[model samples]
Target: MIRRINDIVAKHIQGNLITYFFVILFFMTGISSGAFMSKALTDFQNKELIVYLKNFFSIVDSKAINNLAILKQSLLNNFQTGIIIWILGVTVIGIPLILLIIGLRGFIIGFTVGFFVKQMGFKGVIFSLVSILPQNILIVPCTVFIGVLGISFSLMLIKNKTRKNTRYSIVNQFFLYSTIIAMIHIIIVVGCLIEAYISPFFIKYISTYM
Candidate 1:
């Protein structure tokens, strides 16, 4: 079972390598954009965010776990939304549209992380990880699957890859990809639930010094 699971993961990693690179590239681009944007808006938003954080910390004597939970839940929600958007993009405008959407989402993430990191220093990294990483664990896989599936489908459409068999191969691939995406969605939902209900307290505790 272990070997089988490893093989599956390895296949996924190989198949989705391009998508992964795209995600990373998009993230870096977004970070750059966000840095510039943050410089303009930091004066206002930073103070506001800090004030809010202070107030939040002040109120909760024991909110560490609760804070982490909230952060986790937010991440999960964001991931699920991304997946839904990807599916919609594929259904409405096909693979090109789906890739576009995924790329835009990646950029947004990068921008947000970059902005925060620039503004907050090391603390920003912690904040970003807490805010983004939980759901991202689920999201990266789903996005890769979506991207790979989109590219595969687009090629099939363009090349008439299955003219003789009516493209059953492509259809089968789509079904498999959709199934995997759905499973990822379920995992994200579960993670969100745990984060929302349990993470806040832990977060509050850890962030006290920050």
Candidate 2:
């Protein structure tokens, strides 16, 4: 399994190795900054963090866990993210923007997880697992995959546009590319459903009883 995962990753990152490496570095940097920021909080700030988390979790009544509004919001939010990547992915101009957006997304994940872990201790770790891990586990990989495709497509576009004898027609290639991106959007929707419908249920149970 480990070797299979390595092979899969190696294949995805193969052509765009340097691009992915720099993207991963940016993500790790964000994660480190978030962890350090947690450690640097003043005592009062730490207390405030605890209070904020409590309020965040407690805002909705227990019954609201399955609320349709919440699900709609979650789905829309993730949908927007996926769409952003999809649209930007088609243009050579969007390469740097895509990388920056990915970096920012990672930063947010790191900051939220780091802050929660710091405030709640072991429970923070548990909460992070239940609340953060499930959907993000899906979304993160999707983002990475999208980035790889975007970079690859952009490079292909540049080569095709500049080359004297282009091997593949741009129009046909784009139709197939777009079809795959649509499938990605469908996957993002699934991730959103899991985040909205499933993650909260586990978290509520864990926080209350465990």
Predicted structure 1: lDDT:
0.62
* Candidate 1 vs. true structure, TM-score: 0.68
The residue-by-residue lDDT of candidate 2 on 53-149, one tens digit each, is 6776665334456547767997777767667776776777877877777777777787788887776778878888988899888878777777767
Q: After superposing candidate 1 on the true structure, give the runs of residues whose Cα lies further than 4 Å from its correct spot.
A: 59-76, 79-93, 115-119, 161-164
**What RMSD does model 1 have?**
4.1
135-190, model 1: which lDDT tens digit per residue? 56765655655565555545555566436766677577667766766676676666
List the global CA lDDT of all models.
0.62, 0.75
Ten residues in a row with the worst lDDT in model 1?
84-93
TM-score of every prediction relative to native? 0.68, 0.81
lDDT of 2 at 42: 90
Cα shift from native, residue 154, model 2 (Å): 1.5
